[model samples]
Target chain A: MTESVITVEHGAVAYDDRPVLRDVSVRITPGEVVAVLGANGSGKSTLVRAILGLVPLNAGRVTLFGTPQRRFRQWWRIGYVPQRLGAGSGVPATVAEVVASGRLARRGVLRPAGGADRRAVAEALQAVGLTERAGDPVVTLSGGQQQRTLIARALAGQPELLVLDEPTAGVDSASQDAFAEALRGFVAGGRTVLLVAHELGPLAPLITRAVVVHEGTIAHDGAVPEPAGHHATPGHEHVHPHAPDESSGLWGS
Target chain B: MSLFQYDFMIRALVGALVIGLTAPALGIYLVQRRMSLIGDGVGHIALTGVGIGLLLDRSPVLMAVLVSAVAAVAIELIRERGRTPGDVALALMFYGGIAGGVMLVGLSGSRSNANLMAYLFGSLTTTSPQDLTVIVVLAVLVLGTMLVLRPALFAISHDEEYARVSGLPVRALNLLLAVTTAVTVTISMRAVGLLLVSALMVVPVATAQLFSRGFLATMLAAMGIGLVAAGSGVWLAGTIDTALGATIVILAIGIFLVVAVGAAARRALVRRRAVPAGTAAAVEPCDVVLEPAPTSPTPALDLDGPDHAAVPR
Candidate 1:
């Protein structure tokens, strides 16, 4: 059997004395697109955060690329796309500039962006179909385009594993298709993906496995669950019954 | 040009240029992190440091740097804990700072309120040769660090979570920024004054954002605006015999207002010209597809059930 890219054994986490995740274990191997699904307040996001060491786990251990997470220093091997754009922090940063930041890990803080870094940034932008808007300030882009810009930033790092938290939460359909296409290209390179999502829209087909989290534990870990009812209909306006809630736990609170 | 003949005037101008260049250079990151007002809080704390220096007969500039650096780190810690609202923590520092400075200065019998006023409103024309030396050394240090760490600083300020996952050392960078901001405040004490130092740090960046489209462009533009404002303000204050710090701040604000009005007017003009063309490009009607509606409401899938799983490859 191939070694897993990510390993979580009996993982648990809590925020402010309130338990958010408990006794959760997941293993992901290379080239697999795994979806983490759950209702609001179900600790799905916390699970991913725990794996990435964003939040402290109360119990259990997590390893990345066969190395213990705490000892893992090879961050350039992983790309992370956060949930949403933070309005660019009221700063005017061009698309290319933001994407170029992804190379900081590989390029180091003191060194300037070399020729290879520039080419990687440019290629990432092109993969997301944002080459035309490379010169525009990120704040000027639409919501979906901003999302694409973020994806381009993650891609610029050239990581083997990509972890995204709801990359399509508020994106438009066209941009979603573009993102899906970008993911298709990423997976074609034998990369791994683990995402936390409420509803898998354009990205549903690419998912190879599913891990369902219901109240801080993994309820099902196998094949992706097929969408039933309105979700099964094409062009049905992607709306899930789960009202966006405080289930985001540490991040939302 | 006659102002150059005076030794004090030349020193003041040199000091002004240094503060002008460094304030906004470091301020850009603070603005990016939405901590623009942090400089103001640090400035207040530096006042307490100045008071301590006056009491102990130590170099005020060095003392202010030390005290303000400590306070700034405390603020960063408080912000990281997130237990208290950022503004509340700043408020505590603001009141405690001014009060401490006043009380300390009072306790020192040799120094009077006039001495405190020099640091409060600035006495640029009285900048001693030693003060200039300190200013130049500290300014170079600040500028060098900012240049070398621009990428990491920009990444952390723009999106901290992403920077952390990238292994860029977010906490250390944040502390470094806090310390840098403190140094900026202390260095500007002789030119823009502690009270108005934040104006130099924030206003120029705000002014530059009006037209800049990228982070580097904004920083360069803000520094340009700062240099121009500081230089002209010093020159004009010498010519008119006005307060140096107030003059510089007012000049920076004047530039901001002019750019703001100009930007608004240009936007209005563009809108007026585009109105006609915009209407002409209205969307044309397209065919609509109708699908059959299901008679019964479909049951929500039981995601927790293993039976609902997709076929395994």
Candidate 2:
């Protein structure tokens, strides 16, 4: 069997002593596209946080490529795109400045970004279909463009693994389509991806496997059986009418 | 030439430069974090410390620095302990510090209320060589910390969680910011006085941000702007014979507004020009097709789409 790129054994997480994720065990092999699904506050983001060492595991071990979460190294090999990238977060940084930040791990301190860094940044932007908007103020971009910029930031790292928490959350339908297309390209390039999402219906077809997180435990983990009645074949698109909208509620229409 | 040649004028210029460079260097982080009031809080806390030292016949500035540093740590610890935001904690500590210093001064009943006024309001004309030396050393230390902590600063600035995920020492960096703020505040107190020091720290960085992109350039621009404001403010104070710190801060604000408006106009002009050059550099030629293999590696998971056919694992 292929060695697991991420190993979580009986992991538990909490905030202020109230448990969020508990005794959860999961193993993700290298190159697998895993989707973590759950309702609101199902501890999905918390689990991702635990795996990335952003949240302390109360009871179990989280190892990324054999290294324990606390000791996880090769930072340049991992990239993250959060749910929201606020443009005016007081940093007053432009899109390029924000994207260049993805190179911090590789650049270390005081060492300036060189020629290769610029190329990677450009390519990442191009991959996200954001080459035209590269110089725009991150704050000035529409919601979709900002999200794409965030994804480009992760891609700039050229990470072996990319973790996204709700990549399409709060994004427009068209932007979501574009984001999905870009992600498909990423996986095609031999990289791995793990994502935590609220509504899995719209993105179900693209997911290789679904791990349902309920009450901090894996409620379901298996290859997603083709959704009952939806047949996705060559030259056909899977349509889920519940395209998420701001007022349509979290689960969607 | 005489302004540069005179001893007192030289001291004022050098003093302004040192404080200008140091306060805003630390202020960049403060402004980014929405902790602009920290300089004010630290200054007040340092005053209480200085009062304590004066009561004990010690170097007031030294006492102030030590006290403020400890207070900075305390503020951080408090912030971490409770769920209160950093700015809220800073305001509380700021008021608490001012009250404590006032009480201490009332109890001690020291001579020369005017001297206290001078320190509180800033008087660059009285800077001693020793004061300049201390400011220089402290400025170097602050700059050194800024350089060493650039990554952490960037992390804290954007996507703090991702920064933590990337294995940045976040807590350590936070503490470093606290200490640096305290030190910078203490040094700036002599130049702008305790009350107006925060204005000096915040205005330069804010003004610099008008024209710059990227973190390093912003800081450089902030330092350059700060120097101009400080020098100009000191000269204005000399001409008008008003409070030096107040003059400096007002001048800094004026400069900030002018730069901000000009920069905004320039950006609008550029955007208008780019309307026609839309195809020039906006979009690249290589983005025609974007399709990666389904059988890619593990870490390349895309959060979008239903194309998960690759990866035998």
Candidate 3:
């Protein structure tokens, strides 16, 4: 497709001499919507960190857009929504201020934010439907809204690669759907997404390709096989439901 | 009334003002970072300095400042290296410093028990002219440093990883914060004593947090509360001839309670303003609603078209 956006060849990450990921090799093309499916501590998050150069690679190498991992400047083309942004409960920052901080990288050192930065901040706020509550303290928002505010903060940078670690975790059902829909829109608008998600029931349709991470290595890298023994009948709730049709024997396999 | 008033009351007022203003300013960062308990622990660490000063027959303020700075950096280093958070490290440091100080005091042959007791609490009436100058200089320097590093402060406070990734010197900023905390505790020790320095550090910020909408507002409100507590504490201490340190801390706690109640009341009023989404009563209430937000529809793009590639533009 377009130039390879990310290349991880023989990459390994270890924590305290215990291997978290081993000899993983994956190539992500530009404009691709890739979902990394895995259980907790399956190294999906590690892989994301490896790509972002947050983790030191124990084995081979990772390159982003032709630049070596260390040479790349934080992969500014990539956006990140870490697992814990507001883990500090009483931080006393507003949703808008948090979003505005995303622009700090662009507006360095004592320099004030300009019109474009403010507009981007507002647009990012609107993207996650948090414009109405922009002035509210982030601690006061529900869990899902807080997560969305983080997403909007990422959006403020307008990065091409969006890396989210469990963005929908701890969110309510409706908010989960909202997050999925927002991610789907980002992918559809010619941007790339590398999301780590655990829910296969609802997230299958929103993703374009699958990279299943199991036991610190990629198990499968392809289209998801259809759910076994399932049929979509017209006018039923299962009709065109997010999952693929039966016969591929991939559901819970 | 002038900035240069030289009477004992004016000097005490000025000293208290400087200490009060500086403590909360530095305290905001510690509190925001959730290391507020560290402030309490560090206050005890200052006692070790006092004990050392007495043992060596040195200037208590000088020894206190030196020992406090070293202890502050040690706490940070220990916290950074240890897997446990800064709060736990602070507590450990607190006990360690106090134990060391008590042992040192015991080892000394002099009967300096009264000096130790005064240092344990606080004595603002004994604040020397040199102490005032140090407090004023520390306050001004601390505030100036914060102003210079405002951007880095926001970056670290919001998303430390992102800030580090974007090339801000995260570790250096952290060291700066540690130094600020040390200076704040040392200067404030003159006004509130080591025992209640945390009350001086955290109360004003906690009180301001209730009403502040943003960081600047929070800082402003905290400074105002600190000034009020300092002024009222000095006034009461002068009238009653009681301990100024204890008086300032009590006044700050009182303000904290008032602000906490006001914050609760304001929240209740806002909660009442939230009407049914479709009801006409919503028009008369606040313009904002606190309900969950709706999601947007996913956009569809043609992959086979000329614009198939992902571009930020």
Candidate 4:
């Protein structure tokens, strides 16, 4: 850890009149993989979104690299991987083209992408194992591959910190592994990562810290929680260990 | 030389080329933004401008620009409110605009109602020198703005929320697009008429999207298609004694149809050559594919949308 990359103090987000994130405070330092985890409707995504300044804060303040979110214009230093839904949304853009878009913020819209831009794009694609399919239309890729393309698009910017929202959701196991591998390479460069996930799955091992959201507040923060009495099966998928196996119960009582 | 024999023919040809370039040039952005029908909406609003011009004794084209500009801004405002999706807002504005124009035309008590039809059908031999100059200026403005904002526009159109987070001025850029779209619609009304102008804008772009791999490629392809369509349509109309506007739209559509069929055939061929996958993932249950078990007391994180404030990193 070197420098603090993100700081959120008593952050609150509201959708209309209803408060989504009642209160959240998170801080990320350099060379850390911080995972924000919770169940559906727990406001984990909102918390990350609030820090990213994608959602307006109802209360509290957030800073990125010591700059307040509002006046912050240094977007090139931060790379963001939105959910899987961001892929193939509009325009029949190719893998290379979409990846090149990451360079727009760094190079500005007016300047043409030069050698450095192309080099960065190619390197990002290679990191995500997508260099071979760089010429294909994004629409032609599978959901998981599309997700990887987005990750590559983010990585192309060569940001100091990466924020991902459910990057592996809807992705297959293989794709998830690739995402983890690409992220590992990215963070190995002294960068930091902040992500929101329902289940860590393949990403669990990479996480240095975990923050759980429960009812619009931070319920737990520090080491990842495996709930009560849950352990790995060693050779197979880790199953939740419970005495009566009441894990199949529906949500909200 | 023979084709350029008549001065009227020369003017018609010049007008065709202007609309040909501008329509599809702007069309590329409109299509990519999924607001392809915005041309039609603006055109309808231009009709109201024409009616206002007739009543107020002003330049009809200028009036059309003003009216459509206001209309485009109104649409943008509606979009900003996020009360409705773009298509719905455009639809509302479309019918309302035309309705207002029709009433204004009647209320003006002008005997030149037949002349109003000229705006709908377009006159092949009636483009004045003044009209030609206006067309050139309009075309230049549209093209220059597009060139300057090309990258930012592409980012915003691709994903608005992402673009905003990247510190691009999304709202201002969207408004710029709206105003430019209005100018294109009003200017094109002279060559393609209000009813058919959208065809020139949308059809060529749609045709280009069939094979073009990137944004610039698609725009260039669209411009090429538009040039061919406009030139051939005007020539064909002159020879066959038909309406130039309708002819141009029809030609554009014909090209789109050809390209669409070719694209489908290419896709089929590629699919046949590809190897089949081992998994039938589409048949898998939705819960199995997307969700972790709901049983765990650890609350699941929902996928939320992006916020608008620009974050520094």
Best by DockQ: 1
Tell me the tens digit of each residue's lDDT in model 1 across A2-111.
98999999999989889999999899999999999887778989999899999988999999999999999999999999888764467688899999999997877789
Clashing pairs in 4: A38-B299, A38-B300, A39-B299, A39-B300, A39-B301, A40-B300, A54-B307, A55-B307
Off by over 4 Å in 1: A229-253, B83-87, B276-313
lDDT by residue (tens digit), candidate 2, B1-313 = 3456668778888888878877788888788877677788788888787678767777777888898999988887776565548657777777888777766765667874765676577777888888888988998999878867665686665666766655566677778788888888888878888888899889998887666645666777788778888888778887777777888899889998887676656556555654454444336554431232233222122221111121111
- Candidate 4 lDDT by residue in tens digits, B58-109: 8889999999999999988887777548668778788888888877777777
- Listed in order, the DockQ scores are 0.36, 0.25, 0.20, 0.24
Instruction: Indicate the residue-level lDDT of B201 in model 3.
Output: 79
In angstroms, how far off is B281's CA in candidate 3? 9.4
Stretches of candidate 2 off by over 4 Å are A16-18, A86-88, A200-206, A225-253, B1-5, B85-92, B105-112, B147-151, B210-217, B259-313
TM-score of 4: 0.85
Error of 2 at A25 (Å): 1.6
Poorest stretch of ten by lDDT in candidate 3 chain B = B302-311
Please tell me the TM-score of chain B in candidate 2 relative to the true structure's chain B: 0.81
Report interface Cα RMSD per prediction: 5.9, 4.7, 6.4, 4.5
What stretches of model 4 exceed 4 Å from their correct place? Answer: A1-3, A85-90, A227-253, B1-3, B85-92, B107-110, B265-313
Interface RMSD of 2: 4.7
Off by over 4 Å in 3: A1-4, A53-56, A170-190, A200-208, A224-253, B1-6, B51-59, B82-92, B102-111, B165-167, B263-313
Q: Clashes per prediction?
A: 1, 25, 0, 8
